[model samples]
Target chain A: DTAVSQTPKYLVTQMGNDKSIKCEQNLGHDTMYWYKQDSKKFLKIMFSYNNKELIINETVPNRFSPKSPDKAHLNLHINSLELGDSAVYFCAIGWGNTIYFGEGSWLTVV
Target chain B: GESVGLHLPTLSVQEGDNSIINCAYSNSASDYFIWYKQESGKGPQFIIDIRSNMDKRQGQRVTVLLNKTVKHLSLQIAATQPGDSAVYFCAALRAGNNRKLIWGLGTSLAVNP
Candidate 1:
């Protein structure tokens, strides 16, 4: 069973288009996170939800929003996707001191 | 801004040799540290972790060492194989930061046979 999974393994869209990436975790973890990995392989945290409550919100732009319907699912919605938004997005679930990440979703905005 | 960074961007090693990846963090408040391995087209995988209270922790073939005084961390791999070639990242979590992991830019490990 895939502990953490995200839909749309690859996304390619033009600028100004809005798209959403859905994530789900079956690990029954209390905290879920969204991270962006740039071309340089630098991983940066964007948002984190603990039991469906917003906890960590990095300095990401307003156009990028994260919604967690429940502790098992967290989705990212990007509006007016710009060229800078092109990167790999990963969903992760944390328990205690360890975290498990899903196969990332590659997003490219032209 | 406080962040975790790696010293070398890339490292090449022989298949049967040992490998060590080093990382430094500017946040002295961080108490928990972890090392992750990421293969091509995949997410980062947890390898080993260490806390400020302890200097070293060992896994199957991996070891993590933390130096709180210097705010440094290192991951050591034994008998690295071709499958071990991947990008290794070090992350730190502050004491009161709700476990938000501050990540390092990753070191690419190339294991040559």
Candidate 2:
């Protein structure tokens, strides 16, 4: 019973390549979020979806797009990835005042 | 454009000792706060949270203290064990219509045996 899960625990691709990371939550939460943790361990909010509606879109670049097919799933798609995009992408589900995070997807662009 | 940050990036403590991690947030409108623990390869895990009305909240062996006047928050772990060694982050949620949480750069805790 994994509450929140993200696929492709590790992703390695060459520069200029495009990829996607899938996420799902079984917690039946109404809100989902995508966060990026850089090499310096700074966690930044990228996007958030509430009931499949885009709620928050931070200063994320246009290359990063988040799609929510339903209340239980939110996926991140990156176009023309760059070396600076290499970091850990985390998906989370919010429950009232608390948020549960996935294991995280590590993306490395060479 | 408020930022949440930590006083120290890393802290080391011996087993059975109490550990305190400090965080400073610039947003006065933040009404909710949470503490998360992240292990080496895992994402941050929820620990405890506090509301702006309350200055302190406790859960199990963890306690969260909030100082609204100075816009500071601290997470204190009692009798820290090796299992508690992880990176901890403090996040704040704005008070109004939106519920987006602003996260701070984490503090890595190392519990020495």
Candidate 3:
């Protein structure tokens, strides 16, 4: 069983479309995070939730919003997606100083 | 905003040799740091970690060094193998925030056979 899993491993859509990516972790972690890995292999933290409360939010766009139904799941919803949003999105769980990541969801905006 | 960065975008090393990956962090308030390895088409895997109170920690074939003076961190791998080839990243946790980890751009390590 995967400790962390994400839905829609690959997403392809047109610009201005709305899309969502779902993530879940079974590791019983209190903290979950959303990260974006760009074409340059730069991994940036987009948002972080600890116990369903937002703990960290970087300079991300307004079109992107994250929702946490519970401590085990965090979903990201993007509105009016743009070509710049074409990247691999990852879900991660933080336990102490160690963090575990999901397989990642590749999103492409054509 | 403060960030963690690497000295190089890529690293090439021969198999069986030791490998060292370096990182520089701008935030002294960071209390914890980690090293992760990401292969193609996959998410990052945790390698090792160091806390602000410690200078170094080791596990298996990996070792992490933290220098709070220069705000620097380094990962050392023993007897690098071909399977060790991947992008390595350094991330830091804010002093008060345990969930948030500031990530680096990553350094691609190419292990030559």
DockQ comparisons of all candidates to the true complex: 0.71, 0.68, 0.70
What's model 3's TM-score? 0.93
lDDT of each: 0.91, 0.90, 0.91
Q: Give stretches of model 2 more than 4 Å off.
A: B95-97
lDDT of 2 by residue, B25-102 (tens): 998877788898999999888899999889999999999999999999999999999999999999987643246778
TM-score of each: 0.96, 0.95, 0.93
Interface RMSD values, listed in order for every candidate: 1.7, 1.8, 1.8
Least lDDT summed over 10 consecutive residues: which range in candidate 2 chain B? Answer: B93-102
What are the runs in model 1 whose C-alpha is more than 4 Å off?
Answer: B95-97
Itemize residue pairs with steric clashes in candidate 3.
Answer: none
Fnat values, one per model, are 0.74, 0.69, 0.76
Question: 2 or 3: which has the higher TM-score?
Answer: 2
DockQ winner = 1
lDDT string, candidate 1, B1-113, tens digits: 78999999999999999999999999877778889999999999988888879988999988888887898889999999999999999988764426688888999999999
Give the worst 10-residue stretch by lDDT in candidate 3 chain B.
B93-102
